[model samples]
Target chain A: MVPLYWYLWLGSVVFAVGIFGFLTRRNIIIMFLSIELMLNGVNISLVALSHYMQDLRGQILVFFVIAVAAAEAAIGLAIIIAMFRNKATLHADEIAEMKG
Target chain B: MVEWFFGYLAGAVILLSILVVLSRNPVHSVLWMLLMFLHVAGLYLLLNAEFLAATQVIVYAGAILVLFLFVVMLLNLKEELRIKRFTGGWPFRLLIAAGILIILKKVLDGFKVGFKGPWSIEAIEQATHTKALGKVLFTEYILPFEIASLILLVAIIGAVFLAKKRLRT
Candidate 1:
C-alpha cells in the first residue's frame, strides 16, 4: 500500500547507526549490542525485500540469521563472562590480552 | 494515516536501536534492543510476513535478548563499569557518520531496481508464509539448514568447553 522504499531507507539508516556503534564502542557488551543492531537492521531489510519481491527466500534467510545470532549470543556472553571473571573488567580496551 | 503510523513506528524503533547502542548501562541497552526487536516484528507484520513477525518476536525478544539481560545482571558489572566514549569526540564521530552516509547514498543511488507492488495480506493468509517457507526450506534448503544446526551444536559444546576449566573425567 505505502511505499516500500520507506522501509528500506529506515533499515539502511538503522544499519548505518549500528555500524557506527560497532566501530565506536569500546565495551564488549556494547559492541555486541551494536552487532545485534546491525543484524536487526539486516533483518528489517530482508523482510522488506522479501515482501516486495514476493519471494520467501529472504524470510528463510532471516530464520537462519536468527539461529546464528542465538548461537553467537550464547558463545559471546559465555566468553565475556569467562573474561570478566579473571580481568574484572568488561571494557574491550582493558582486556587486550586474550590469553592469560 | 496508516502510513504515518508505520513511519512513526519505524522511527521509534530506530531511535530505540540508537539508544541501545549509546546507553552506558548494559541493562538499559538490552531493554532498548528488545523494543527494537518488537518494532521490527511490527514491520514484518506490515510486510505480510506474519509468521516471520511472530518468530522474530519469540526468538529475539523472548529468548536471545533475555539471555543477554541475564548475563548482564549476573555479572553485576555496574560497579566496575567504565564510562568511556566511543571515539575521540562526538562531533567528529557524527561528521564521519555523515561522510559515510553521503558515500552510501552515492553508492546506492546508481543501482536501479524496479519495485513490484505490495502483496495483499488476504492473498497470503491462505497458505501462510511459514508453511510456504517450511516447505521450501525442507525441500530445497534442507542440507544447509541441517548443517547450520550442526554448527550450532558444535558452538554450544565449544562454549561449554571454553567457559569451563575442565570436563569431568
Candidate 2:
C-alpha cells in the first residue's frame, strides 16, 4: 500500500487547483464550483486521515462541514439570483457599478 | 493490475475535475462535477472507509450536487454561462498556482515521514470504521456533535429567513 502522505499530496493538489479556479474565474457560479472543489479536497484529506488514524472524529467533522457548505451554497445562490434580477450579467467585472 | 486500475481511475477523475473547472457552461460543469464526485466516492472505498464512501455518495452526490444542478436550471443560465469571458487575473494566477505546488512538493519531500500511529493495512482491516467511529463519536465527541448540530440548525433558520422576500405586514 502507498503511504498516507501520498493522499495528502493529492488533496493538496486538488486544493491548489480549486484555489486557482476561484481566483481566476469571473462567474459567480464557477467560483462556487471552485469552492466546492476546495471543500471536497479537504474532505478527501479528512477521510483519509480518519481511516489512517482509526478514528471517526474526522468523519464527523466532514458531516458538519458538509452541512455548512450546503447552507452557504443555498444562501449564496439566493443572493446571486437576486443580483441577477437587478443586473443583467453574472460576470464579476460587471459588478463594478458598486465602485465608490 | 491494482496499480493500473488506481492510476486510470485517478486520471479519469482528475480529467473530469479539470473539465468541471474549465467548462463555461454551468450545467455541463455541474454534470462533470457529479462524475467527479462519484469517482471520489470510489476513492473512499479504496481507502477502506466504507461508511465514509457511502456518506460521500449520499451526501455529496445525492444532496449537494443535486442542489447545484437545481440552481443552475432554475436560474435558466444555459445561454448566460456560454458567454466567453474571464476575470481580471489571467496567466499570473496560473504561474502562482504552479509556484505553490512546487514549494509544497519541496516541503513535503524534506520531511522524514513515518506512520507514527497504527495505520497498517492489516490494522485497518480489524477496525470497523462505522462501529469504532460510532463509539468514539458518541462517547468522546458527543459534546462537539451536539454543538455542531445546534449550529447547523441555526444556519438553516438563517437561510430560510434570508430567502424570504418580504416581511408579512
Candidate 3:
C-alpha cells in the first residue's frame, strides 16, 4: 500500500505549481485554472487522508470541496466573460482599471 | 502494482499541472488541465475513492474544463496569444512557489493520524462507497448538503445574470 505521505507530496507539488501560475500568469482564465489546480490538490490530499484513516468524513469534505469548486468555476468564468465584454481584453494588467 | 499505478498517476498529474501553468496559449492550458484532472481521478481511484474518482472525471474533467474551453473560445484571443504574457518579476513568482512547497512539505511532515472511524475498506466494500457516502451525507451532513445546493443555486443565478446581455443599457 502506498503511504499517505506520497499522496500529500503529490498534492503539495500541484498546489505549488498552481501558486506559481496564479502569481506569474497574466491571463485571467489561466489564473482561474490555477485556482482549480490548487483545489484539486487539496481534494487529492483529503481523499487520500480519508482513505488511510478509514474515515468517511474527509471524503465527505471532498464532496463539499468539489461542489464549491464547481460553483467557483461557474461564477469565475461568468465574471471573465463579463469582464471581456466590458473591456475587450483578457490581460489582467491592462484590465487593471475598474472603468470600461 | 498499486505503487506503480500511483507513481504513474502522480507523475502524469504533476507534469500536466506544470504544463497548464507554463503553456503560452490559454487554450492549451485548459486542455492540459483536462488531462491533469483525468490523472487526478486515477489517483483518487487508487485511494479507494471510486465514487470520488467518478465525480472527479464527470464534474471536473467533463464540466469545468469544458467551461474553461468555452470561455477561451469566446474571448477570441489572437492578439493575446501573440505576446508571451507573464507578470513582472520572475523571482517573486519562484519565491512564492518555493515558499508554498516548503510550507506544504513541513505541514505534512509533522502530520499526525487522527482518530480512525468505522469506515474501513471492508466495511465500505460491504456497504459500497457511494451508498455509505450518501447515507452520511444525507444524515449527519444534511445541513451542509443543503447549503451546498443553495450555493449552487446562487452560482447559477449569478452566472446567468453576469453573462446576460444588458438588453437596454
Among the numbered candidates, top DockQ falls to 3
Alpha-carbon shift of residue A33 in model 2 (angstroms)? 0.8
Candidate 1 residues lying further than 4 Å off, grouped into runs, are A98-100, B89-93, B114-123, B166-169
lDDT of 1 at B155: 76
Descending-DockQ candidate ranking: 3, 1, 2
Query: Candidate 1 DockQ category?
Result: medium
TM-score, prediction 1: 0.90
lDDT of 3 by residue, A1-100 (tens): 8988999899999989889999999889999999999998899999988998999999999989999999999999999999989888888887756676
Best by lDDT: 3
Candidate 2 local lDDT, residue A56:
58
Error of 1 at B113 (Å): 3.5
Decreasing lDDT order of the candidates: 3, 1, 2
lDDT of 2: 0.75
lDDT of 1 by residue, B1-49 (tens): 7697798789898789889878878888889888888888888888888
Candidate with better lDDT, 1 vs 3: 3
The better candidate by lDDT, 1 or 2, is: 1
State the displacement of the C-alpha of residue A96, model 3, in Å, after optimal TM-score superposition: 2.1
Clashing pairs in 2: none
Task: Please state the CAPRI-style docking class of candidate 2.
Answer: medium
DockQ each candidate and list the results. 0.57, 0.50, 0.86
Candidate 2 residue-wise lDDT, B1-169, digit = tens: 5556556666767677778778878888889888988888887887777877788789888987887788777776755757765565668998887788788788767755434454445654566567666766788788887887777777677667655676569
